[model samples]
Target: MPDNKTGPFLQGITRLLTDGTLGTTDIVESMHHRIVHPPLLPSTPIQHLITGIAGITYRNIKWSTRLIGKGIDKSLYKLAPFLGEIKDTPKKVALVSILNGILGDYLEINNNPLAIQMNLKNQDRDTSIDASSQACELRNVKGRILIMVHGSCGNDFQWNQEDHNHGIALAEKFDKTALFLNYNSGCHVSSNGKDLNKLLERLIYIWPVPVEEITIISHSMGGLVTRSAYHYGRLNDNGWIKHCSKMVFLGTPHHGAPLERIGNYLDTILHVIPYTTPISKLGKIRSAGITDLRYGHVVEEDWKDRDRFELSGDQRNIVPLPDGVECFAIAGITGKTSDKPSIRKSGDKMVSLNSALGIHKDPEKSLEFKKKNTWISEETTHSELLSNKYVFNKLASWMK
Candidate 1:
């Protein structure tokens, strides 16, 4: 028999399929409309007939699938109450994390089971941030705290990939208590940031010992979330901000990811062609989190009430590093060296070197990262930065 968690996962999948089908139908219908009435380009009579039939077929299939999916979801919900509880395996956690990264905002709005809640874990168990619980569960609690935040389509457990957990390694080497954050990556960066701001405030207040210093090590999208959190925390005068002394951003797309930008461009080009416009809408089907990577939008003002899929130039608000905090950025390059312009432009296969290092053409938009504080590793993948020995040495030196 399947466990309680299985029901929600199944239901979520069903809903996703239903939405996808409906979206496809809408795209086909739009293409048919454009074929019948050409705006910029003309379509043949046969093209019109073909799109019309395809549109009708897609609509019928969409309705049929939606009805069947809803019926199955209801049955699953009924059986969920009687299902046995199951322990979360690493594979299960990873799958849910990917789902959250892709459709996290939808899951959150629908209260789906796959939407991960933000939690602090120690030795694979929730600490609950309660003073007594921390004392009992974290025997090695100390004044110094190291918080590790994972990236897009990832979870806290992923940080321990291939027996290389940076938080554990850093804790062992630096004598600081380490905490891992597991959160829904599909949500807007600002939304997660605001929640993190509150969570950190509560954590600092309930710590077992007097907190002397706090360091955040963030990877990829986690860096944006952390920056957003700090932005809100400072605005609200959160006390935890004072304790945060250092931040290390690993493969962070400080400017934005070029891949997402390319996706946006394709979306525009597809919209211009009436026949392929629906396919263009498919390109826009990526989650809000993925869209945010286009310009590293972190604050509410950056994306509120905006059509995220609209083709637009950089509109991100300038968010400089927090004052009085030592900030370090590390960018990875897959090339043998950074001397090659092409390699530098395609840093780590996901983030560009300039973006990772917070280098901007406009000086006002650039983050003031001192040369001594920034490091670049050639022939290193973005994921490898999490476990690279040289990267570890740099992190250790900064912390010390």
Candidate 2:
């Protein structure tokens, strides 16, 4: 039998409730322990049981908060004109707090869950691909292999949409094969990148036929993963670079997203509360999602011109880039200003025009690719940039 923490935990809770041994501090301490020491088997039966119990607790708190937010949103939407009529800090704070609550709810609930699981399959099946002689049957007959890496909180299905998922479109356009690289966004950047590089090395070596080319189109944090994978591939002399012919970045924060810093502030404040541990995990700067957005943890001297943010390796170009690879970037500009309307003007609320297009050389600027190699679209949001019609065409054009 498994060493069951949940079994004991549940029994303890029952006993505490019956004997009145459980106090708020005791409950809080138990929860804190569980949160800090996440189970090794997230999906194990015991873990699932514990998670279900926790989920119920979460629902109670979340529902109350959500209802309050709904009420506040209704009030705010109705009080649009009243903002000018009343000049009070308390009101302003209340309105701001309401807006924040609503935004948080929308972000959490509106995300595409189908896209989250599109590439997830039996991990065992993936590992066994190497053992089978027929592992790469599709690649052997195909002329090229297209690997797709998705952005933050995105999945392969995000690329499956006819309008936005570029990898599927490219496969049909080129009659080539494709593979979706799926990974958790919560780990460390270098760790995930190294794993991707290793996977790529295995795929290429087992490929049954000559791979004419290997092309990648990455969005947001995916771009950073691409770079990190390339860096590790070269650093380890993994030879995965030999298969890569082209790469494209869409709305990638080559430097870093200012909003993330803002999020860090918000997360810091939220973390002080005992109820916010799950939400707080999303903002750790060292998380793979965050690190990729910031590139590396440390900035390198050489990258100072291209990327202004200081990551651990931001100043060092120590990571070797793929040889003879074509790199292109497409930036988004919703509008010109930082005002709400500016989001409509140049950037995808999350990323700005200058940052998207690699226009500013101050922080590290993007490499100057040939006109045919680069694509810029200011009309799309960061999320929408990946599937823009013109952007897809540009990616296809480059491959040709």
Candidate 3:
């Protein structure tokens, strides 16, 4: 699916040479950002879509999961020692909102505004032009845009430009428009999906000229948001899905993260103590930390349509790709080795090969890749999948 244009190819190759080497600090910065900013609850978009309100609702429920066991209260106190390790989530959310708001307002159209009117009317004619002519016309066509959706606790800045992350490399290689998706990771996946749908609707409606294509590359929980946007967010309502020719997911837990379950279990153990004053009235399941820890929210039975998805058995699957979209996924794994480099060996401290691949209690219901989209690299930790050269190149090849 690589673009037929040479301009993008030259631009990409030029950037690769100019950027030179990647830095370790840059890699750490990317990881640091993911540890802090979780996305908003998925319900955030539901409210907006159904009720036309932008606010979130909370219902406080005691952490009853802890009350089921004996002597667990004393054990819970032991975990108190670990509570200090939880990062400053609130500040992270604030920073993410600020950063994304800035990008959406600034980079989206600030430098190269779209044309006054853009639609599919003359696309066939436009496609007939030569490469140079097409390049010249594209200069006036507003750059090709890639909308990136970050995983839970992720920010737009998480993909460091200097690093090997997929978004950065794809942006560099394509020389198209690139916009990072930043949202409250604490929100529910479905909510964010709906919000994204709305956001896309607004973007196209207001685009300077007719948009030809849009690519969405997401990581971890971000993939769920992307799916939810498609399934429930009404993205196809306005030809949005048609515009999205490519979708790439990097280590996205299609089934949900196993680490989240562990954290939720531990949190339940901590909530039993009567002395532990709850910081917010939000329900235990609804809290930002616990929600991600628990994966997607359990809704009505109809919502758990198992037949709707495909699994990889271990991080691979022929995802229920939206109609008309070319979808693929990249998963990170820690190679079995004694001398592996630091970045290559670790699967982002949080996500592991098992979880990244969506291997869960029900292996039968996991996502299976129709074909190996491409194994980017086993060296990078989970978070580094997007930056890895192998993955990015394969993706760039697909995009073209």
lDDT of each: 0.84, 0.55, 0.50
Global lDDT for candidate 2? 0.55
Considering TM-score, which of the candidate structures 2 and 3 is the better prediction for this target?
A: 2
Better of 1 and 3 by lDDT: 1
> Which stretches of model 3 miss by more than 4 angstroms?
1-143, 161-169, 233-236, 271-293, 296-319, 336-348, 358-364, 374-376
In candidate 3, residue 379 scores what lDDT?
60
Candidate 3 lDDT trough over 10 residues, lowest sum: 112-121
Q: Mind giving the per-residue lDDT tens digits that candidate 2 earns over 76-193?
A: 4454443433332334423322322222222223331111111222112232232123455442247587877776655555565543457766777887776776655444345456
User: How do the residues 1-400 of candidate 1 rate in per-residue lDDT, one tens digit apiece?
Assistant: 5446767777777787777777767876776676576776778888777777886787788779888978988997998867666557888788889988888888898777678888778755655452223333466589898989889998777787667888888888988988888888898888888888888887887777899999999999999999999999999999999999999999999899988999999999988876787678777667888889998988988899889999999988889999988999999998866376976768999999999999999999999998999999878898998888888888888988
Q: Over the stretch 277-379, how does candidate 3's per-residue lDDT look in tens digits?
A: 1311112323231243344431212233432122112322223447767777777765633445554434556565544554446646555544655353556
Which candidate number maximizes lDDT? 1
Winner of 2 and 3 under lDDT: 2
Ranking by TM-score: 1, 2, 3
Worst 10 residues of 2 by lDDT: 112-121
Model 1 root-mean-square deviation = 3.4
